[model samples]
Target chain A: MSVSVAQTALLDKEPQFRHAIPTRDGRTARNRARYTFTVLAFLLPSAIPLLLFVLGPMVAAAWVSLHKWNLLAPMQWVGLGNYAKLLTDPITGDVFVHTIYYIAGYLPLVYFGGLALALALNTALKGRSILRGIYFLPVVTSWIVVALVWRWLLSPTSGIVNTVLAAVGIHGPGWWTDPHWAMPAIIVASSWKDLGFVMVILLAGLQAIPTELYDASKVDGAGWWRRLFSVTLPLLSPSTFFVIVISLINGFQVFDQVYAMTGGGPNGASEVVVQQIYDLTFRYGRAGEASALSWMLFAVVLAVTVIQVRGQRRWVTYG
Target chain B: MAEALLTARTPARRTVGRAPRSREAKLRLAGVIVLHLVIIVGAIAMFFPFLWTIITSITPGASLTTTPALIPKNPSLGAYQRLFVERPFGQVILNSFLLAVITTAVQLVTSSTAAYAFSRLPFRGQNVVFGVYLATMMIPLQVLIVPLFVELKAFGLLDTYLGALLPTFATAFGIFLLRQAINQVPRELDEAATIDGAGHFRIFTGIILPNIRPAIATLVVFAFMGSWNSFLWPLVVLRSPELQTLPIALAGLQGQYTSQWDVIMAGSVVSVLPMLALYVFAQKYVIQGVASSGIK
Candidate 1:
């Protein structure tokens, strides 16, 4: 009876009729067979590499996570111990807090600073394209290169930043050495590297707004300040949403900059979760602990994704 | 006569409003100029380090610390010479170059095909399969590092080129993006090919590939950059310094600290120059790819 009701409900929407297999002529059947072979051949080239590297590794990781083992050691039957140990680590907890601080610092510099810069560029002017390219130059360059550049800039006594500050009658702290300043300096550098991308995304959002909306506002005696509040802010929210989502994701995965600039140094003040995990695994040779930490990071990112995906439905407009 | 004087006075007063209007326009112009100046200056603020790296790299080592000139007062190739002469720099560059090329080629071929299959083909459980594929994009490598390392060991592929290349063979974003790219290829073309005697493979290779060169080019540049600059996996798997990629070796330059600035900067310049050149040449494709990804 339940099956009948389910079938009736499905059919009420529109029953999907299954078509019989076509009895094609020799030529058509040959063509179909050829098409099948073509797709299979095309797919094989792409699928094989992924199957070996990504899919296989994923399953293997889960299996390994269940057992306690390290390199040069036999597997111990510690089913949930690896998982439990990650939750209890004091250092991992500290890293998690700093990671949140990093995000807090990262958001304002990029989201707000990027939007403001993008808006400034969207103005009608000569040499705008040239300016855009200069801003975006870092986006294309690898973070490894950017990190190297900032390492020099953030070098405290000999660095240009401090030198310039000294010229202005202000003393600058040793940025890379000062634990309090390390993460912030790293944030400043990451923000610089990231501005080009944020600028572009925001530029796209700005361009998409209809000129008519602005014109209408102007006709109704709205000034630049008034029009921005009424029209631009609402329209720009979707782009803002996209930026925040990815920015949050990036905040979670910020390793290269921290790894390159500070190496989680000045006594682990700049240490992010990923770098902490790297240290445990590669530095300390604690594979299980690192893996456990990784799972913790993964869980955090997962929760954030769930919230953003759900939140997007309410605020993100397709256009 | 009295009314006419009053009208003239009113018209004269209206001209005062016009005077302030011109003044307001001047003020607006001044404000815009100041804003642009600030933005431009800020943009330059971030690039000072890069500028210094390039300048210092050209400077002779003796003057590097003694004089630290912006224009590299006595510019020389001495550091570049040391980078190559004192180390396996050439081999490392070749390793990075070859690894980047092969990885990109493998990724493009594999990703485009899987994308096409997932996009164009009507297979059994297609959505489910593709969902599984998309899910992999978020599985951070750190989580799987231990298992992958163990697996590579079992396969006896540690420190091998294949081991370096294996993990990135399939990128979820590549497939997703390429599928977005290939979906724009009209289904009518495939149907027409079917109408002809051409097999599926012939149609795909001959018809599809020729059309989607831009997307493929975009993928090639992106893949090249990703593999060339990779750090963690290379650091972990490759125990031999000779087998290390440029990034790994360059990162190792960090241990030398203050003494290694010029050499490290030289290495940084070496690691990035090829990519910068490639980007300059194929910038049209790269920019379009970057811009389109914004909308996505």
Candidate 2:
């Protein structure tokens, strides 16, 4: 019996197959426990950690949203005060507005920048690999560093960007200081750092396209612009859709760049929701409001992602 | 096939007729050159910040962040010295490195197995479980800050290393990536291992681990990079000066008006150097992962 059992195990060693037996038997009961235990092996250390650290914190923030709690004081049951404050509070409104403005400029710059870069490099050219390294450098560089360099570059008087502009007899705005240009400058800086990332995604989409399609188009006497419009654009939608979904999610959570570049400053024209949450929770110890704001962002991101995913099925082409 | 290939691309290669070597050939060459040059220049524009950081870190305080000091007037290790003497900058680096290593190690192990289960093995609520995992990715991490803080307080994990790594240790992205990678791995490999009477754990650890080495490396570098670059989570979790990670410490430093530019640059260099080295080593995989992982 032992030999036969061992041989049977050897015959079908896959875990899923081993557990695919249909029965009301004792062996099946034991297999159930073993399967559950095996599943827990993966969950115990990894998923649970995120569940605790990432997911748990999100849920706690929501719970805190219902209260009037701060770091200094005990939680007070001021149910829904934080959420209510979100609608009526002028400061919250300002932060929300600035967050959208930053997104408005930053997203287009990054998305288009990535797409153009991907297209430019798609041709069979010498040193394409080297071009990739150069393009992707900023995506890996720390935000602290990018922000620092930009801080210098955008410095009004002696900064290189303005210095170059002055050469053309046009003065660049005091980027970090002027309320009008502070957020825009931050967007430009952020876009510079993020362009490579988008390029890589769009590039992957570019590479995934079939060479035969291009040949077929060429056979039919299609030109560069025509080939791009009919073949490349349609085929590249999946990658672009993926990039858009991610960039938008990341757009809502813009913090480090803003923290380093603008400090949400020059009359708070760049104050984002995450920055606001950071101030409320860390600076002011207002955990409730921070959690409330976080929940709001989560909802917005969730809805956006779902809508995008559903919308993607109709438009995005996959091979 | 090999012997025949040695004689290929002979007279038969010319069947397409004389290639257009007129205006079109020259035009194509010119276009490629101009296009590639634009990409190269844009690449420089993006990467200039990293070079600037490295250069500035070694420079002294003179003409830093002022006067078009593109190059230091007199470069010095003066910033490095100031970094250590001025504050607990070394502690911040140590904390970030230590936390990143620990978090990444746990995430890799857990995410791999879970991903294996999702991709290879069927269980109750399998689809639902996977959906739940993907669905959770959209939940703004900031949402759980309040609850996690409270939970940490209950366990006295707040302001501790474990607290910092706990929430990030099991990540959805890790699972998602591992699942995709594992799914691509031939099921025959698993079947062969299992047919040898190996238990599920043994099969995964033995056959799966060895085969998925490249995928694992990809995950490791990414997990390390993300955790290392993580700021907001550590900021919310740890408040003590000695406990803060690199970004948190840098933020604290910059939060105070009149931040010493030299020392901050030094700290920034410290935070970025390890990842830079890792990138230099695994440039291909890291770059690919960064570009693709934008799915958030």
Give the candidate number with the greatest TM-score: 2
Looking at candidate 2, what is the lDDT of residue B204? 80
Residues B1-296 of candidate 1 have per-residue lDDT tens digits of 22221222122334355544576545654565676578779768755556667787786553233435767667778778888998788999999999898888888878888877765676667657665565565556776766778789999999888888888777766675566455444455666776897755676687666555545665676688789888778887888777889888886775763565677778877887787666545535534544453321
Candidate 1 — which residues are off by over 4 angstroms? A1-48, A112-133, A136-174, A197-246, A315-319, B1-36, B62-67, B85-91, B109-143, B156-159, B176-220, B235-244, B252-258, B285-296
DockQ of 1: 0.22
* Chain A TM-score for each of the predictions: 0.78, 0.82
Tell me the tens digit of each residue's lDDT in model 1 across A1-319: 2333222322332211122122445558776676567667767775676677777877766666666656558766677787787777787788988889999988888888888777776765446656766676676566766775676676787877888999999999888799889988988998888887677666655654545455555567666665566567655665676578667766887887888788888898988888876776667766666666666676687678667756754644322
lDDT scores for all predictions?
0.68, 0.69
Q: What is the TM-score of each candidate against the true structure?
A: 0.71, 0.75
Model 1 Cα displacement at A69 (Å)? Answer: 2.7
